[model samples]
Target: MTKKQPKSDATRRRNRVDSSTRQPKPPKSDPNNFHGSNNHHFLAIIAVVFVVSSAISAFLYRRINHPSLPPSFAHQRGLVKEDVTFQEILTENSRVSENVTQRHFTNPVLAYITPWNSAGYDLAKRFCPKFTHLSPVWYDLKSQGTKLVLEGRHNADTGWMSELRLRGNAQILPRVVLEAVPKDLLRSKKQRDKAIDLLITECKDIGYDGIVLESWSRWAAHGVLHDASLRKLALQFVKQLGDSLHNVRSQRNGQPLQLVYVIGPPYSESEKLQAHDFGPEDLRTLSDSVDGFSLMTYDYSSSYSPGPNAPLTWVHSTIKLLVGEGGKSLANKIFVGINFYGNDYVVAEGGGARAITGRDYLSLVDQYKPTMRWQKDFAEHFFVYSDDQHHEHAVFYPTLMSIAERLKEARSWGAGISIWEIGQGLDYFFDLL
Candidate 1:
């Protein structure tokens, strides 16, 4: 495929301008919040706006611009350089010949998995059966290829150094995310910027993809975005921070393929789930902001009726909710999530809690596997019992059988599938996805 150069229109602007100049801070207002005497959006809208505008400017000026880049900013399109240690990892993983170092992960089975330390990587492979794990952070590459990687956390102290040692020549920590604090300087933008700026500069200088923020909601919305008092300070800090990595791909912590936010099943979730009411479009907006959305379809209703075997229609409708309601563009990006654990309740004389954990459920299954029989339900799975206490129970786990059931859903939905957390599944749950 040719590197298509988009045409330019009234090129009133140059794409070279960084986010600092773009996302302006909102006007100030008297403030009162937890972080007392404060107000403002944390990341502001500058980076987003600048990135979007650049695309536009690039298109409009494509046909007539000189050098393509505005001025001293022209560089060849090439692979984002990989960190030394991780480079060795890729080399080992990507080996092709029958050589000992032919490369373990050259084909790029999985793009990016999260919190993917050694254990996480092992567990993830169980569900993402076909993909090999790689670090999205340190594995810098400009274009797509068979580059498989997983997300790993890195603080200022370790950076990529420790990751390199642990992963050895097999796994690579290509990128690093500075999940640190100036503890002393957090309240002051100047202090915060200086701290963050230092990390960002190191990342760019050393060659990293970019930074992964502390998921936006947990980030800006925590009162910072709304505060009007210190908004300008916050904006300046963020703009400078963004500039440190605007051209960089992403802070490796975030994998490339968008996340499919698994919408918990409303019926089973009861009231514990948040955001269930958010329709597909709302989900789509959320999805657009990041990567994608996922619908969780685990049932605890019956052995044959449809809880574990949720009514085909319900499943179809849920998928439609995101695709049709949210628009196919967004919906198509949806990935379905399946349950990997069981729920059971041990009522305590009239008013006890009903949510029993996997450990307990396993015990019951063990004690009853000989005498107890369960029927699949319309939602997920269930075992019939009229305990002397009248308690209810649900069963699920990503055992071989459970995984088989999930695979059917992932393929049918035409979206990716991810288990809630690898921690919940059986040890060998991913033995075969």
Candidate 2:
């Protein structure tokens, strides 16, 4: 240090100033200086390299794991399974439950649907509001009529019925019958009882709303339908069946079960030439046993005989005879069958005809462009058409207008009306209903 000289006031003040507080040194100009801007430039370069390297690593990893996929395809690859999840099922079930309570009709407008007709379900769904009950004709007995069998159908029918019930909120009562209640089974009371029990169990297990018992002969075991002993046994069997059905628990309302007994046209003693001839006593028992009875007012003329299936006058006369005896009070419990089918008779000597649907008849009418007329006496729409073979054809079919007229007659009788079969694609009839 030089000989110390008394410093000036400004110099002393400057020296007293704190070195820590001194202005930082201006960055050095050397590009390689550790404390210079070159350090910041180096750091930036390293950062850019790290970012680029990370992106490249991610891309390579994806390519290794999932080859041939674009960068944007990452999300789409994760969704592979295409099926309804439990969450979706839960939502649908909730929706169906909410929808089932809204019924369109209080009185039953029952529609009979055969299992072979898949199109029936579609038409049923479309015209669900017009129907209050849907009876799927499926269950039938073996030829001997001892055991119940599913013929021309599958177990999936139950599922389809359930679906129809759920979606349409219509009561689903399937039709059951002993195609020809075997004579031996009827003779053996034990066998008849077992069959009845099986029928009940099957109905309950399948969640059917009700059942239709259609037996050709009250006492099939008796060679004669009018045998007094056979008739007595049939009465007892029906009574037991009714009691058991009433006792079973119902999925709907938790009440007694619904049972329908389909009977042949009730005829007087003189008119009892038909196979199933049940006297007034038998009719009384039927009226007393089941919830309701259906009169099959069709098949008076079959394809074997070329004539009207259900003549209006004949049906009316039968109805009068049914109520003329002990069954007079059971009119309200009766449902008249509305046959949706017809026969086209050949004008030749054979008097043979083919079975045709209402739609089929309409198509024939369109094809042949026949001379059509409505018969007031028969209450049927008639047409005469010549085929390409130059053979004259006579067609007598029930049209929407005629069917409506018959329905009015049924309603006047304080009875219900049921369509013989659905899935005719009868939009005209569907709209009318």
Candidate 3:
């Protein structure tokens, strides 16, 4: 009844305001507020998807690009398996053989075979034509009282020897090491006679064309070379052995047996102060007795320091010392030793260096993708790399170019070359031979 009586303008306006507030006035539209809440949820979902997608992409990329290497590469970087087939080796050798020019070498090309590495056996058969003499590192001359006994005859492969002779006409000279005491063989005439007879009998019985005797180093280690009287007796013993072997005939080829004397390199002046092994004097003394002198020219560096395996300068100096004034005649009989292996040294603490094969050299190259460098002075290949644990390493190895340089140098000196053992080298190494 009171509201019906109120008809004033102020009253009407106040009543209208009150009615609008109570009825909510059909709710106004605020575009920013409405869209902001919905956009926040949409952006959050998009962000999560982007983050997950990015993580997946990164993982996939790493897996696709980088693969794990063999477990053997994990430790002992020096030793690695030559993961190649015989046919693959033959294929590579065939490719290398195509570019080879046929040239006759006046001197013998000796290749050594080791029983431990089966690759040497296969390679010897494959590249038989490249060598004039094949020396299997077998046979040790040990003494039992007055009688002399021979060991390591079980390693002889008659079938392999027969194949080698037939295919390449190479002489099979089994390497003989004098494991007996120096006094037993050098001092006693009866012992020397027995030793000579033992070698000759083995050569005749085993169809060996010759014997590669390695006793000077042993005798030198035993201080036999230091004593004047013992040295003379040692030379006489070698002469006697050589003369007896030359007198005997090989059962396989009616030819006189050959005797190769393995001699150590001349020690440096500093090294001579410590110990003296066989030098130029020994080479000359045994020149008339032995058919060939195997000069050990490698091992210029030791594991204590990172240096070349065989420095070119050192090699030249060594050859110069041995083949003195107009000594090309002696050089013809000398077989310069060439190493096919390499060395890897770790620069970090508790790290040491070791000898590495071609396969091992290649594995390191693949894993690290390091910058390879050619040591111009030493004529070798080397590189530096960091391992997974951030350890730095230096590697020195022989390449085709380095090996070719050595071959050319030896040929220039009119000296034959002897690989330490063919198994330690790459398949293409025989191409130089």
Candidate 4:
């Protein structure tokens, strides 16, 4: 009360700031404080994450849409790593054909018809004009001797004649599968010669355009030994058959009957997972003995597992082997197999898968509307989904894009292509042709 000594101006201001009722002091603002810096830092971090995520999503989209982006052809046998590109293949395809009238595909498009199935007939009627050759399964070698026997009713019926007529001048090369024959009979030169003669006579009598000799060890009960025998006899049969068939003009058209040999995958001798009798030497021999060779590149992973019908990676590997110096000479005459079907499995791991045609697969996709994704590593499309009971299913198949990549590979190597079973393909499948 000592008359609250007259306060100084500075003392009055300090008192005002300290007093709660004094104008409610304005808050302090510091640009370098912890809360302000922390907020700015968080905003900066968020911006960086957003940019990174957007970039990753874009990259994945590009990869999935265009799976056939050319890889380093460095290890691929035929092309120079730097020179080969997808653009180059497209250009080659567009190059003018020798027949100035035609600028279409240069390679032969062979369609395989399983005569036992009605679908084959439908495929023949629908796609006959599009194919370069129609290979109808007609004959199978007998177990008793190297005898050619009719496979099914279609072989003996006049229906094949009408079907052949629908081919629009396409070659009618009946496929003669050497599957059920005894290895011993095939090994015996006398029996092999008899069989070759019989095949030629039957082909001439039947008015077929040509013949395709298919040898599969799995089709026969014999294991490695049987494969070995067939492998040895394959060259003999091919050489004899080619010499005999080509020398004898077809009674119908007076043209040299063409001969083709369907071989197993071009695996190196070391990898013997499947029973294979043919080796590099056998391949070369067969190549020498036939008008051309068709490598069975499909069925790499069939109903055995939930996997791609034909993985592009493996197809590339097979291409490398065939186009390599070892099999280079056979490149032009080679025809790689393509599957028009897929495999559907109960699980992605171990289970018996069922064959699904391209058409059937599309219908299933529509029905289930499952989650589908492009498998980048394999260069194939696969999907996973849960059923009503929550049972997961996986389906893998080829799309037009994937098949285009394969065709590119074949074109790069100057090889032809053949569909495993024409009936399984979707109608649009022929559109690519």
Give the count of colliding residue pairs in each prediction.
Answer: 64, 0, 0, 0
In model 4, what are the clashing residue pairs, if there are any? Answer: none
TM per candidate? 0.42, 0.69, 0.75, 0.69
Give the better candidate number (1 or 3) by TM-score.
Answer: 3
Instruction: Give the alpha carbon lDDT tens digit for every residue of 1-433 in model 2.
Output: 0011121212211221211121212221222321222224323422342343222342233224432212111113231122312232222211221232333223457787765555677767766766867777667654434454434235336656655656666677777766444555556777777777777777677777778776643333234355656656666777778777878877765767778776666433234433345445556766666777767776554222334456555566566566665555667777777776666755443334565664566577657665445544335555566667655566666654456555655655667767777664354455335
Write the residue-wise lDDT of candidate 1 on 223-245 in tens digits. Answer: 34345444334334444554444
Best by lDDT: 3
Best by TM-score: 3
Clashing pairs in 3: none
- Cα-lDDT of candidate 1: 0.33
Q: What's the lDDT for residue 94 in model 2?
A: 13
lDDT of 4 by residue, 1-433 (tens): 0001111222222221221211211222121221221233322422342333222343344345543323222112232222333333223322221222221345787877764345866767655666777887667665544344544334644566666675566677877766444555556777777777777777777777778876543333244234555655655667888878888786556888889877656433222333343445555665655887777666544222234556555565565554555666568887888877676655422334566665567666767765445544345556655556554556766554556566766766677888777766655445455
Task: Estimate the lDDT of model 2.
Answer: 0.54
TM-score of 2: 0.69
> Which of candidates 1 and 2 reaches a greater lDDT?
2
Question: Residues 1-433, candidate 3, lDDT per residue (tens digit)?
Answer: 0001112222222222221211111111121221221334322432342343222342333334433222221112222122322233223432444323332344578887777656788888887877888888888898887778998889989998888876777898988888888887788888888888888888888889999988876776677777889989988888888888888888877888999887666654422322345656666777887889877677554333445677655566567667766776788888888877677755444445666766776677667766555544455666677667765566777665566556656766778887777877787666556
